[model samples]
Target: MKETYEEKINRRLKVKQRIIEVAAGREKADLVIKNATYLNVFSNEFLQGDIAVANGLIAGIGEYEGEKEIDVNGKIVLPGFIDAHIHLESAMVTPSEFAKAVISHGTTTVITDPHEIANVMGLNGIDYMIESTQNLPVDVYFMLPSCVPATAFDESGAGLGYKDIDSYFEHKKVLGLAEMMNYVGVINGDGDVVSKIIASQAHHKKIDGHAPELSGNDLNAYIAAGVYSDHECSTFENALEKLRKGQFIMIREGTAAHNLSALMPLLTKQYSDRCMFATDDKHPSDLLNGGHIDYIVKQALKNGADPIVTLKAATHNAARYFLLNNKGAIAPGYLADIVVADNFADFNVEMVFKRGKLIFDGEVKEFDAPSVDETLVEKCHNTFNLDEVTPNSFKVDGKLGLIGLVGGELLTRNLGFADKTDVENDILKIACVERHKNTNHIGVGYVKGYSLKSGAVATSVAHDSHNIITIGCSDTDIAVAVNAIRKAKGGIAVVENGEVKALLELPVAGLMSEEKLETVNEKLEKAKAEAYRLGADKSIDPFMTLSFLSLPVIPSLRITTKGVFDVEKCELLKDEMSV
Candidate 1:
């Protein structure tokens, strides 16, 4: 029998008394940590004290008695760091797996948008993710996907409107709206966008922002539509302007979108309070090696940021922005979700406690992650529906506009040139195959600076549309890579000379792995190695870099299932162009 909300409330009231008793010294705290130097995010200073925990909440601080005690020897203890915004799907792993990877890195809180999954499996997918993450050491919150298909131009598996997201608005774990990617609709006061915002506001939920490169009045217009936080500011001017306009700046350092270094300089004392740290879409390999939010903090510090300010942005600022009460503070009555780090500069997580229960003990061998619910996987049709694929399908003629790859960022430069076969010049064929409706639609073009001297990479993890996108020097290798992904149902593949070199299968609606985080990382690393062997430069993940060419939301140039897109003008290119 499922317990009602009233029953849960009554049970919580009973625990409330126990917590009060523990705080008053009448009852024993379940556990206590003594001699720890507090991060004290609330006061912006360090304090030395013992923290008392009972009923998964901070019962008291200073001179509290407990049944069990852990000594820290004055190590720095702060609220477990919070990742202000993230897309769990980008980790290419399930929610439980993503939690396992980041919990050890001291990220106790994550605000995620499951729009990618929703685009495939619809509302069922969102529900599956919600059920999948319950009772974990890390606290994962949801920002209901405001734009499932992203825009009208692309064909996604699902098209969610207000009805789809309305129910999740009041869910305690569902914070508010995800990034409102449809800034065009918001600016133009489109009814659909306005109604979605109204639904979130009616429920009093925080709206996350995703306006990349919008400046001045346009940015203000987007903000005025009720997006309170942004993780897509890719430039210093945009980041500062967003902060100036009262939109919380989420400095994102993700797998494809690396905006931290560019925006870190904006972490000035005067504006630091409005800033927060978020890895919008980090891959598992990067998460395992680079160390999640701690890695972001370390990078910000290396970029000459103020230590205290940086730490605040990493923790308190996010908590306050999301209104995660009883979090982001080392004070009485706050959640006893703390991270014991050896030092602030390195941010080496020694131990982590969620609700006073030790989750990560700084020992990898002894760790056990929360079990995932297999039933929560909203099974859908395999996302490979290409009617027929051939080497000839990838051929493009005339003046070609190529998405020029940047070394450390996602923003692409549009390079125009005549189509020709030149391996040295790095003019390679890029295609976005229609996967949703199987309209026999393919957007074929060429891209420069990809550095794929030979072979090809294909992925069904293409952004927003989640189409089958492939890039290759030769049509046969591209076909092989794409065929391998199709055989896997949905996945990423690297092919050379008509043979699959590396493949990572993402069978779950073509976007994420259902396997363990470690497994996904191994597969991704192997694929990345194969990409490098194919002459893909070490500067980027060729698979992911190719995947983003289909995301029309970013800027400059991109492709959708319909055709090649000039994002600035929102124009779709046709069959003819100057060569």
Candidate 2:
């Protein structure tokens, strides 16, 4: 008879038991740390005990003898945190490399959405992520990408039908379908949308949602379709409505959206069971400095959330919601993934353990990181049919309808049109180019409120599809911006006075960098400062704002490299300059 997956794992764990057995069995075992207190988030209590490990699981919870016992008499031991929702690709590093930054912060497990990569390369992208993360010290699980290309109406790099969802279910690491972004499709009874949800259910997987402005009956209908969670809730009332409707509201903090202060009030001990924390799309700088899920835990506690409640949100609640039964709590048979933190206020980590092995003791280790290839970075094509784009083709006249940008948010603020003014009206032009196929489909439109006095900003980090987006003061600047993007392979860049003003290189995937975390962060900070130097005075994170303008699913108004999209109406806005 063949052994089951559980049995196979147990057999291997038993062989790795010698070191742990010695630590727990003797009155001074192989490795013993004496005089430590444990914070049990499960029972909401602090217990005075020494935890013992054997065979990579929590073999004993009380005091024991170890071969080597160190006095850690003043430390606090807490279970390692789990990132309920995140996009690893957004970190701008391969999975193994990203581990080196987050592991020291005591993050032991992460539930990631490969949807960003899926949108650019589809199943192939997801396969690469799965293959790359399997053997790391951190436990990285996945959700089948819920919205490739985000929505059906727009032109994206890849699209998945029923076949793709079925294939994803075969991967044991796949937990569920990722966020269902096309809420309108679910409400309107689109067959393709319904099929994806049904397929997930058939595989015994939970469905995630991305309903930005849905509420009332429409929201209820989407929940009826089986999407149980959403990370796009912006307001308290909306979050309440969704929670009441049976959809778990993921309180999000990201490079673009900051919702912690607004949502913290709702996570009191009374309502804490249903809430969870997620960094939907954080940049590398924030992740490296402020911490990953650890940041969310501190912010929640400081804002009046009970420490136990916040821990549950970051651990158990998310694990249960995602149906990760073997994780979320520290128990006899759990994955032995745990963290020891300094205190409730600072939420500092003293050590991190995963699968019964010490990955970090709050600092660098001698463990070898898995080697990565340059293929994922080089995989994205930068070739565009420049032959079809003339200098005249980049300009548009008359009173032009424009997509408006709101600083500090992913959703755009709608601004109608420029009153038949010249290019001096600050009615900058925005374009999306198809870089994957060298398809010369460049969608052109006017954007208001950027406050860009004189230069053009271009980025390959366009949302969902990862196409190149350029918004600028003049056609000449626009041309220069795209050319620069091609020259660097890919990333965000600014062109002014026939010169490059600033850039953050994303040589990996033409959307990320293979550079060190500190190096990438420094470059991003410089680029942000340079954006203002080049005349974007309205927003702190202007380049990130520029990227979301191309996301077609969020709502109100958006533009893709393909065309101007009206997400509320789910159609292309008419070409008339008048709204």
Candidate 3:
């Protein structure tokens, strides 16, 4: 018999009602994990018990009778990890593909921001992210994109206002509004942003914040807007101050920005509850090499946090901060999203369960590859719309405000270069091409510290807008790379000596690939190697760092279809001297 939606949650509710009966042995448990040393995140104690699961929720504890039971053999049981904040599109793969990569790493839940896609296709893009990730091994929740185009200085294919956000909130998967990236708007009370924030609050939804290096009255004003969490804190003092403001401080450690070591020094037991772990924009290559939240947990433990406290930060703290009901705990009313590991130091998962169903079994090292659902492949369509351009399109001369890319940092420095003489000093020209529309708008500027001695690297995965961004020492090579990307619809391209060295296609909104994680890794590694050979700094992921250059919200200087923007000043950097 087919089960109706009401019938399903009803049956689960009935099981919840019979929890007393099941615990008293009057009713049988659906499944019981026996003899496990489970970490009770509530009391912060390691206790041995048989965890009873029925109707996808924890029905009982202690010794229990069950229809079926599996002996855990004294393994450590902890709540499955949660990634409080992440950009699924940043993985350069679809949500299904991203799920396959991180599930085995012990993440059972992820609060994703589809702002990257929303900025490109609006609500349809947001719905696509929601519908495509259903029925996966992990539970995926979404936060409505607060800034579709990110900033007025840049251009995106679409923009989502209050009506768009209201419609998105109707979806059951949407938790709240995503990061309010326009901190300036939040502080000054821009109409559209204010309306959206009010709408979210009216719906009883929490808001996420993005205020980098903001402090004092500015931070206070932002907090007053009801932004409850922040994942953009990249420094110890900033994180601490945000925590002091009664905000959940998300410590981010991703491929492009490695802020964990800098922030771990502040993760004491007294302040553990206010801090959580997230990889806001982790690359698939990085996810494959280290892990997802589990890697962060290991790092926290190794950094001298008490094992229980560190694990709490990885799990319960995030769920609590997000107000995700019945998640991140080993309680009677909570979900059976649990992980079994042999050790806390370099914790290796032996089994994983989501909603009482085993999704991963055996040791983590014995992981089996998961196939991408072919039906989902239909969503991976191209969004690029621009035609080919000549080498002349990328030429930059005269005084330019060079965007100095700090290694492993989201912020850039506005360095002034009077002429092209800095090319000898390793400063390179960069441009943001308006790929969504064929208006041929290209914002050209110079960038320092890429260390590119030759060649060029380009990507259509430019943040928020998903435009095409190219960086190179040679205009000819830049043209070659951008043209190759246009032909591929969407991808990262490495052009050297006027030839394509490597390319990785991202057919979905010019941001994500349909390839399997392993295949994607292989192709991306080749492309990354080519970029490294072309003189990308060793300290950075050349492809990812390039994508963020067009994000005008992060710092001193950024490019858009309009022109370079002084982010803090919220004005054009045009009068400095146009190229």
Model 1: per-residue Cα lDDT over 439-509, one tens digit each = 88887777777888989999999888798998888988888887788778899999998889899999888
Preferred candidate (lDDT higher): 1 or 3 = 3
Which has the greatest lDDT?
3
Best by TM-score: 1
Per-residue lDDT value at 110 in model 1: 93
Clashing pairs in 1: 398-579, 399-578, 399-579
Clashes of 3: 0
Candidate 2: deviation at residue 410, Å?
Answer: 1.5
TM-scores, each model vs. reference = 0.95, 0.91, 0.94
Clashing pairs in 3: none
Candidate 3: where is the Cα deviation over 4 Å?
1-14, 17-20, 363-380, 421-423, 575-579
lDDT for model 2 comes to 0.75
Give lDDT: candidate 3, residue 496. 90
